[model samples]
Target: MKVNIVGAGVAGLSLAWQLVQQGVEVEMFERGTRVGEKACSWFAGGMLAPWCEAENAEPVVLEYGKESLAWWQNALGEGFVDAKGTLVFAQQRDKKELKRFARRTQAYEVVGHDVISSLEPDLASQYQEALFFKDEAHLDPRKALIRLTEVVQALGVKINFEQEIEPEDLLPEKVVDCRGYNAAKTVQSLRPVKGEMLLVKTNEISLSRPVRLLHPRIPLYVVPRDDQHFMIGATMIENGHGHQFSVRSMLELLGSAYALHSSFAEAEIIEMGVDLRPAFIDNLPRVERDNNIWRINGLYRHGYLLAPYMAKLAADSIFSDTHEIEKLADFKIKEDRV
Candidate 1:
């Protein structure tokens, strides 16, 4: 069957790859110059730490997204990603919050200042304690997206560049829309959570995996990339689509960076960006079928962390009814699997 996908984001591209691998013909249409760029997954921290996410995410997020980091690394290969684990820290004042976080999550060990210092010399003595989720992992989202694009294109999938596709253009064969906020115009009540981010360059601090700093007012995360650069984010504003980072937001980000490690004070700010994460009030992704069109949206912040799992289920969605993936079904699902 020939399937035409409307968006080239992770959901669309990944679904395309999975379908074509199943001996189906696929074509992707992108309104932008390329794929993945339209979605926040492109700039994502790509951390698959369900434990860390448990700090704020719903219970289902941890249970479902836990299989993501390793699944993608194994399928996409090691060169396209990294599974180095994540370290979550906080100031002494936020120690109570950290304890609460640990109490709610699993698969982590407490790290004291000494062990934390040993792991991140640049962050030595910076934080009193941190929670280390060893089973969790992170990757370079930009590189991973590019690699996924290249691989899918090489697999006989045709991509039309800068082509705008309307709903009437969709066909009856398994079409999943992954257009992110663009779908907002189609799905009513869809809200955009504005996330502002900053990139700074400073080899003064090097981190192998993603790190999160718990703050009372604003929570922040720092994702290190190649060439001593780090993608720091973000201020979660409830309304608006302004791409420019506000003065106050930037100051808060930089201050958090400094609080995490003193070396970041000397880092040069490279880039600032803002985008809306399409979401419902619940913040969990929803897959809806309109006629033959399967619309997947509301990824919120889990686009990178959940896209692989989403794609796999999307594939199954095309061929069969999904297994719901609830934790209560775990035992029956596993037992019935073999």
Candidate 2:
């Protein structure tokens, strides 16, 4: 059996990886010149913290997101995923916010400044207490995308870059649409959620894991990368396609970073990026099958956290002789045409 995957984003690449492993021929078409260019996953924080995400997301997200952790580690091999876990903190004035977050999420241990310092010394003096999700992990989205692309290609999947193929154009050809926000026209329920991120480098501070600074307004998360660099993000503005970051957004993001640590104020700005993430009304991912064309979309901000599991469901549905929609009801499998 053979399949044509549209869009080489995390979702499409993940599907290609799974299908090829099952002895299926796979060909991928990406409009971007290379991987992670046109995809919203490029700007992701790459946190695999399902428990942390459960604060705002549904239970299904946490369930499948946990399963995807092993899938990513196995697919990328050793040393790619940082399994140090996630630290969530809030300001003293916003202590209620921390309580609220803890109330909504589970699988975390509340710790004081001593433990916080032990986990990330840079944060010892900044936060009095925090929630630690020990089972969580993170990876660099850019590195993961490039590595996954290489792995799939090595597995005999042909990837055609700079090639644009609409899902409808590949009708009756076993197409999997992972076009994200570009598929808004066909997937009417899909909406664009604009997310903005900034990359900064500072030698003054160090972090071992992703840290979330909870706020009533725009919550912030800073993921550590190699070379004293940190990815600061967390803006979920609704309905916009502009690629440039707004002044207010920049201020809030930077201010939140400063709140995390004073060193960020002097950190060198490495990059600023903005992109629209596709999301459904419930802000969860879905695997929708319409005849021979299957769509793996509505990943929202959970692209890296959920794509692997979503792709598994898509691959299973495709290879199954009988409809597996009922079996995957929790993943929100939709049989209606999109």
Candidate 3:
């Protein structure tokens, strides 16, 4: 059987990879010419910290997201998953925020300044305590998407670029829509959550792993890329695709980074971006069949963290022809018409 996947973001590419592995013929349609283009996955910090995310995310996120790190290693081959872990710290005055985060999360070790210094030397002098999630990992989202496109093609899957598709217009035996925020056009319950991110480069400071800087209003994370570059983000604004970056957000982000390390004050701003991430009212993913199309979306901010598992579930649903779908509430088994 053949499957036509819409949207070449993390979800689409991941599903395509999974289906191809299951010996299914796969063809993908993407509106953008290049991978990551027009997809919010491009702006992601690439953090695989399921435990830290548990501070606000549902328990289900922890279960599925934890599996993603291993899935990515298998998908991308060895050396792709960075297992340096995640470090979370807060200002001395706002240390209560750290306590609250620790209370909500698990699989973390609370470390004092000396241990924190050994783990992240730059942060040791500034913050006296931190929560370390040792099993967490990260990857470069842009690189992963590009490599996924190549891997799928190498596996005999075809990708059609700049091809905007409507599910009804396609004649494929099966269709899987992973269109992220654009899925809102058909899925009314899916809403857009605008997120803004920034890229900066500085040789003044170095961080081995992703670090979260906790603040009362603006919580920020800095994910290190190759060289002296870091991807810092993100502001979660409800609804609307305000594509332009806000001055207030920039101030808060930069101010927070500076608070984490004064060296960030001299860091050269590289790039700034804004994209709308799709989310349900409850901020979880769903798999549902509407006619011949299987819509999988509402990843929210957990794009990299959840794509692997979502793709596996989608592949299993198609292969086994199962009806009792898990995860989200709306998923239901329908008759086989494919």
Candidate 4:
């Protein structure tokens, strides 16, 4: 069957790639000139730390996101994933939150100042204690999306760059909407959660995994990229995508870095971006059919974390002959997870 998809971000590309792999002729439409160019995933920290996300995410998020490790390892090649896990810390006064977080999560060893300093020598004397999620992992988001686009193209997908079309007309055998937050105005209950991020060049410090700095108001994290670069992010504000950064956000983000490691004081700021993550109020992903179209949105901050399984479910729905007659029922998309 011939399949067509909208959007060129990770979700759109992932969907197209999965369909193509199943021997379907897939064509994709992108209003943007390149893949993964303007999407939120481009600036994400790419931490596959499902356990750490347990602090704010649903249990299913971890269950679904854990599949990311093996999927990414297969997609990006072995040794591409940084399996050093996540380092979570709280202020000396907020030690109770740290203990609570540890209690709620799994696969971690409580580390004292000595072990913490030994793990990240640069963090010596900075944090008194930490909970290490030893089973987590992270990846390079920009590289991963680019590689995903390349993989799809190599698999014979016809990616129509700089092209935009409405699904109201010219429907193919199957239509999938991977437009992320843009679907909010169309779908019910899906809201856009604004996320702000920063990329900095730190010749002075090199940390091995992602570090989650606990803040009473604005929780933050730092994801290590290639070379001396690191992606420090994510201020989750309940607003729309406003490119302008708020002064309070900068202060909080920078302050979190300082608390994580003092060497960040000397790092040169590289890039700052803000985008809206499409998410439901429940913060879980959903797949539903509308007339002739299948909508897959509300990835929230879990795009890289959930797209593989989502795409597979979508592809299976499209190929299911029985579902062609019924929308949701035909969508037997059993969360047939990764």
Among all candidates shown, the one with the greatest lDDT = 2
Q: Which parts of model 4 have CA positions greater than 4 angstroms off?
A: 322-338
Better of 1 and 2 by lDDT: 2
- Between prediction 1 and prediction 2, the one with superior TM-score is 2
lDDT, candidate 2, 147-194, per-residue tens: 999999999999999998788887767889999999999999999999
Pick the winner on TM-score between candidates 2 and 4: 2
lDDT of 1 by residue, 1-338 (tens): 77778888777777787787788888888888876656676766667778788777776678778877666776577676666678888888788878877888888889887878777766765776888888887777778778878888888989988888775567656566878888888888689898888889996878888888988788889988899999998788886686777889988999998888888999998988778888887787776666567776788888876666667666666666453422322433565676
Name the regions of candidate 1 deviating beyond 4 angstroms: 172-174, 321-338
Total clashing pairs for each candidate:
0, 0, 1, 2
TM-score of each: 0.91, 0.95, 0.95, 0.91
Model-by-model lDDT, in order? 0.77, 0.90, 0.88, 0.79
Residue 236's lDDT within candidate 4 is 82
Alpha-carbon RMSD to native, per candidate: 3.5, 3.4, 4.1, 3.7
Of candidate 2, the 10-residue stretch with the lowest lDDT total is 329-338
- The regions of model 3 sitting more than 4 angstroms off are 329-338
Question: Can you write out model 4's per-residue Cα lDDT over 171-216, one digit (the tens) per residue?
Answer: 7457788778777667868887888898999888878889888767
Better of 2 and 4 by lDDT: 2
